[model samples]
Target chain A: MEGLNTVGLVEVLTLDGLDDVVRVLRDQGRKVIGPIVRDGVITHDEFDSVSELPHGWTEDQDGGRYRLVPTGTDEVFGFSSPSTSWKRYLYPERTLLIRARRDNGTVEVVQPQPDAPAVAFFGIRSCDLVALGILDRVFLDREATDPTYAARRSDVFIVAAACNRPGKTCFCASMDTGPTPRSGFDLSVRELHGDGRHEFLVEAGSERGTELLATIASRRATTADLDTAQALHGRAAASMGRRMDPQDPPLAALDPDHPRWDDVANRCLACGNCTMVCPTCFCNATEDSTNLTGTEAERWRVWDSCFSIDFSHLHGGSVRSTVKSRYRQWLLHKLVTWHDQFDVSGCVGCGRCITWCPVGIDLTAEITALATPQQSAGRKGVPS
Target chain B: MTPRMYEVVARRDDLPDTVTLTLAPVDEQCPTPAIGQFNMLWAFGIGEAPISLAGFENGHLIHTIRRVGAVTNSLAASTTGDQIGVRGPYGTGWDLTRAAGRDVLVVAGGLGLAPVRPIITELFANRSSYGRAVLLVGARTPDALLYRDELEQWRGRLDIEVEVTVDSATPSWRGDVGVVTRLVERAPIDPENTTAFVCGPEVMMRFAAVSVVDRGVPAAEVMLSLERNMHCAIGHCGHCQLGPEFICKDGPVVPWPRVKPLLRVAER
Candidate 1:
């Protein structure tokens, strides 16, 4: 592995050689988490062997639907994205912040140290990669860093997977975040298939990636292989199932009282599924609980959604009590207010929100409906 | 940030459900919060709530808490010598320097006066530095008024104009009985020269802010403190978000023009 100028070095590896990459990372005492078939659907989980990878399986994702389909071919990175992104690993659903115990008359407070382990994330999609960057800005690039998120995010080995077959709900191309890995990765893998030949084109994006690649048995890529990889990326980019207008006025500028909000509220469930599935939605609430004896207590940070009626609760009552207001807040926050807060759009065009919403409400379509003046004028006075 | 232990040294019942507890750090001194800044008061096994610094006495942090929720109920119920966790001095504070040579108009309703009490204290301490100063306070009823003694003392001072009003009055009550906005409407001031600070329930704030603006004060010159469901009190927790601003960090105090559009949007 020594003396290898790994950065930007592209190489071709067979299916067997691809398995060695996971072996090498595991040998280095890192937890390797990647896409796997779980409950007849693709989801991320920890695996020690490459055989656990969801080979020859693809996902069919559309508005309010998801299903796994088996492809009669050995394609390790066939799925577009799993049900969840790497967020569950980087920022767990729940974290213990502090614990306390009451002595004879005084209370003693103790802050619990964050539990973080070095992890290698395999087969990360490009849209989710951008989502990680967005999360970094939220948690790390601030005056006070979230200790739990910082600890887990500090030591991560990212292996990006370039998409070849974009999903039915994917719009990463319109978001300008996908089809091909751009940056912020240690290594990137592109699976190529055609003409009775199947292989993986792996490229070292960082020095560590190059060294790791040198440990595995692989041959340097030729010009023909590079051309084939570029063509596949081009095809993937053209095959996006949805598109958003880059010139669409910032959703913040849309009328807050637009009739379209009422229209969407009619079908909205206010279940907060979109926020849960979204890679960058970072709202959370803290809970304090005590033991039966009332002597020991713990404080925990749990993910919370703005859609909950209690999210905007003050002394008198909830500020946003109706489903219309909550749904408006979620949409406006993602497409409009997020840019003002984070200097980046919260929606990465991953379409997880569209696919997971129980009512099949597509934000892209909603944005268009809200942007159209005639549609709003035509729907005025329509009861929700 | 982890909360540091603070021992409640003194407690004063301001109202039936409200108490002002003066806390002294068990070991090191916690950072002194500026006027309008707040601290996350942790009630041992209850939880944490963002409480504004009502005042500071000698090195102790003073917080006036009203029992509105579980955490506040616990905090309000705490007696002297009870130890609680405290973390903060968070959020943007009132820039009193902006009011140095200007006429100051402070309008507070209900418990909102707690956050601006320090500002009022500073204005009285540095009386000659500012022009005409006026304070208008309102409560749901006469019994619900906070800082009753302090309001009486300020009313006696001839230099500052102090008006206290209640939504409903007892038969013996002689003070004004109306919303605080009525006082805002009739306050004696050069509209162009006055900087107004208003805080209260959201509806009260909106009406009071509009009244202040109607009195010809620039929207930017009118400052209001906001409240949201805050978990971390830092910007990381997204609960306190209001449009582009994080109420816990960017403000609990913000200029009116910046949040005017947001306030117009109901439930934003």
Candidate 2:
């Protein structure tokens, strides 16, 4: 393939020097956002300094629960992962497509105002990097190009941070999307605090990243730093708290009379919170509104979830009226049917769904409920 | 085609709860939609929903709409020559040419017959060229039957077989009293050389598919129109997704075997 531009790399700043990198990126007209400990969780936030980031913060999650606490080290980069993902950056909760105004007898549609500056997402995790790639496949496919997702994606530059600590809810190792990012990033960093010196193993994947790196001041990496980074990734890989069977069975492989879905649905609130935090969920609903003039009309698009009853509403009634049906659709689409439609699995196993759901519904547990039916007494002689 | 605002045309209480509206087309050709395609009809203030193309007798495209949703309720109450904007003819349509030499079995239930009527008209226009043509229709009541005038005209044809049944009947009625699938059982068909097309509610279509195939009609020879929520008439929006196929493009009209798996899945 013809290269857009040649790739280059430089070691200009330490891990703590990310503040200076953010400052430079901001001056270059990019929206810089990253993880910060807030409200007892590591969530996405705007930051301007190393102090603003979640320093030595780590998250613990079990089922539908998440908590953020300070790690016992002064090493600022100590964190497993954040609950809020990069999806909120690429696909916001809602966006306006048009706002209209009435002129004479005719209606004039006014396009939505220009977008904010392109973003340079900082401290992006490897699983999130894989998540972004998944979203790209869905939203940027030739048949259905989502302009809203595209606009946010194209302008953004990714700065992926290699994971040194794996979260308890994370199954990235099994999902093949974590511990280390293979591609789909501009720059990747491995922060190492060593004997009398703090350094980061920074690599540029793109020309823009190389140019930005050249502006920073730092020394070349010794063979030791490279080894350290590799070892850190290896440790993170082994430290993964969860694992899932990557066996991609067809969704039609599911037994209709399994009786597990109904049991799971009883606990599901249908709040759609799991989908909201998931980096790969891209279902949307379109809304049309008229201005006060009543003549001019505008159309807007917002994120929609399959969990909602209204999402399946037809002429007279909803196709899937019950919570069981909605939950089944979500699981089947994510694991099985989405592969049929998009030629890719809909999830990266980033653990957002497990942590953010109001009822800590573990996808792995649900899959286990189906995969090993004989293990559970609930499956015996029960109707779906 | 891009969506645009449109004024409503005349809407009258043509049948008890049904409204017959003449939609003003936004495009030049009045969007010469194929037989099984549908349009996303919308009222100005109310919401928009998919409605089948019932008839195109005049310059005004005729739509037999039931007063169901907010959009249709508002449309039912519209006046003469009122304006309504329409977008579509979206989704796959019937392959009329492919079924040319075979016996045609057109099975429809209630409002489902409205979308199938156009193809029946197209076939009748060239009546001599095709083989035996039969229309088996079913409705909840005789009053709920669509296109009474057209059904009468079809019943009088020498070459066509017309059979209609209702789930229940009135005291004055003297016709088949059973489910629509029962009419399919009674219709004389050369199953080996016949093509059956069904359009109705999901349950009705499923039952009809069984009835058609049980009579010896090949599963592949049966056609069905599947319904799903559609946001963008083009396939860009994911709302109308039915398995791997987009109901907006791949179908509304899909062969029985092709969509059989999706029929069993609840949320699709």
What TM-score would every model get versus the actual structure?
0.96, 0.90
Per-residue accuracy of model 1 over A1-384 as CA lDDT, tens digit each: 211244477889887888899888888899999998988888898998878988899889999999998877878888886899778788889988888899876777788889999899999999999999999998896688888889989879999899888888899999888878888888898997868887899988888988888888888888888888888888888988888764575565687778888899999999999999999998888999999999999999898999999898888888889998899889888888888888888888888998899988999898898887643432222111
Residue pairs in collision within model 2:
A64-A360, B7-B83, B7-B84, B8-B82, B8-B83, B8-B84, B9-B82, B9-B83
**Candidate 1: where are CA atoms >4 Å away?**
A1-7, A374-384
Model 1 docking tier (incorrect/acceptable/medium/high)? medium
Question: DockQ (Cα-based) per candidate?
Answer: 0.56, 0.39
Q: State in Å the error of residue A90, model 1.
A: 0.9
Q: Considering the two chains of model 2, state its CAPRI-style docking category.
A: acceptable
Candidate that scores best on TM-score: 1
Per lDDT, the best of the predicted structures is 1
lDDT of 2 by residue, A1-384 (tens): 011132446353676466667888888877688887778778887777667877767777767788776775555566766777788677777777656554443334345653655888888887888778878887787855766777888878888777777888888888888777667777777777646656677777787887777777767656666677777777888888777765844345776446787798899999998888888887888787776767766666788988888887887788888898788788877887778776777878788888888888898878877764443323222112
Provide the lDDT at B140 for model 2: 88
